[model samples]
Target: MEKRVVFDGKLLPYALLMPQLLITIIFFYWPAAQAVWQSFFIQDAFGLTMQFVWFENYSVLFANPDYYRSMVTTLVFSCLVTFFSLSIALMFAVQADKHIKAAGAYKTFLMWPYAVAPAIAGVLWLFMFQPSLGLVAQAIRALGVDWNPQLNGGHAMTLVVMAATWKQISYNFLFFLAGLQSIPKSVIEAAAIDGARPARRFWTIIFPLLSPTTFFLLVVNIVYVFFDTFGIIDSVTGGGPAQATTTLVYKVFSDGRLGGDLGGSAAQSVILMILVIGLTAIQFRYIERKVQY
Candidate 1:
């Protein structure tokens, strides 16, 4: 009787969690485990031949010049997108938090971009930057500057970063606005009573309280830029101008889809997973600690 009761009690909580646990195992954990396993070997003979290579894929990847360049491009793209998106989101959030009229309308308008699909966003940007038909391109030419991604690697990268950052900013802004609203109004009033200037109050009180939101958004934005926005790269630059915009994720896609290098692609996926996990761990260990409750 005692054993039966204990078993039933233990099973109840686990039964309640079974659906989510199964979904995680099926969708996330299984694929991840497979990718890690396959990274150590190469497939041949139409999936009939398998040999344990033990870091050969990684060795070749690190030795390849194109891989190194892709890694660098990915890092730079993630950093620039995260920084610009978070900064602009913070600015907009602060403005939207005020008692100014039309704040709701402004926020709605700003958030419209976030609703657009990333692939569509990329196509829209492409149209806006077309050298002959693009409005911005025409303006740049009028300023005696030739803005051609086809001819300039740096220009291509700039276009990709700008497109990705534009899509990310609205999402970050939503989080930041929520964080701002959640802050206790009394804290700001107390700072004002202390004769603190508006800028000082913001820097000393508002910014600190917003740190938790900022940290959360930072991690999310970084991961999104790293993994999810490949559509922007595909539509805007196509990793073009001599592979300047070819990021790690883009390389993985190209290798798997175009190059027929499944094992290599799997290796890249594993590396990317490791990189994200390592960065997230570091953020939780150090950055999250600094965030105010």
Candidate 2:
């Protein structure tokens, strides 16, 4: 027989959930509702007049070529950031998981970057890669490559991608390390006893067990690249070298706050929200199938 615990007091459960529910309503739902409502109307630059233009803002947004460019930029940026951040973090986690000296200090140093603010992280990278004065830029130029991110679109995109990847790696590393630690040592020992090499053991035994963690990190990294990378793009490139690094979220900021196209920005935000939801749903539906747990 299976044993079960029953909660006789229904109000207790509701009471426990109230705070979180309220917070979600206030922060997420309210803002989302506002964005949706505002998407249908156009606000003037002077804030003195408004026009009710249902779907016009969205139509104009869709027709804009730069918007499509931003979408492409966003897709590429998200893919690169997600791939490098997860893969490199996993690599580091694997190495750090070994019985090495000063392991605590090693992990502490690895995790320190996660505590840095995104804008601050971007600024730090910017200072290290600034074409005229940055240390990394100087070194790259010394290698005979024309290293000018300010004038080169490709270089600007690369810079933002590097900064974004660097910002996210520490977060992924923390989770990967936790997942590595959680795997039972007995199972690993059993695999080793079977004459399995270290790489074979990791790919065949360890990796399969880490699927759940990897899947979770994949979702988080996608979300991070789509939304959380705004600060990095802003502080580093301001979405430039001719809008080379202008991702969807950054475009939203550039349009609304900077360009003063509030309605169109809101529409972009709605579309972005929908796109992320669709991606997450697809991941959960298809990708989750491969997860061991």
C-alpha RMSD values across all candidates: 3.3, 1.5
Q: How far in Å is the alpha carbon of 25 misplaced in model 2?
A: 0.2
| C-alpha lDDT of residue 8 in model 1 | 46
**Residues 35-60 of candidate 1: C-alpha lDDT, one tens digit per residue:** 88888888862678888899998888
What is the TM-score of each predicted model, taking all chains together?
A: 0.94, 0.96
In candidate 2, where is summed lDDT lowest over 10 consecutive residues?
A: 43-52
Best by TM-score: 2
* lDDT (10s digit) by residue, model 2, range 108-210: 9999889889999999999999988899999999999999999899999889989889988999999999999999999999989999999999999899999
Collision pairs in model 1 = none
Q: Candidate 1 overall Cα lDDT vs. reference? A: 0.90
Residue 162's lDDT within candidate 1 is 88
Model 1 / residue 106 / CA error / Å: 1.2
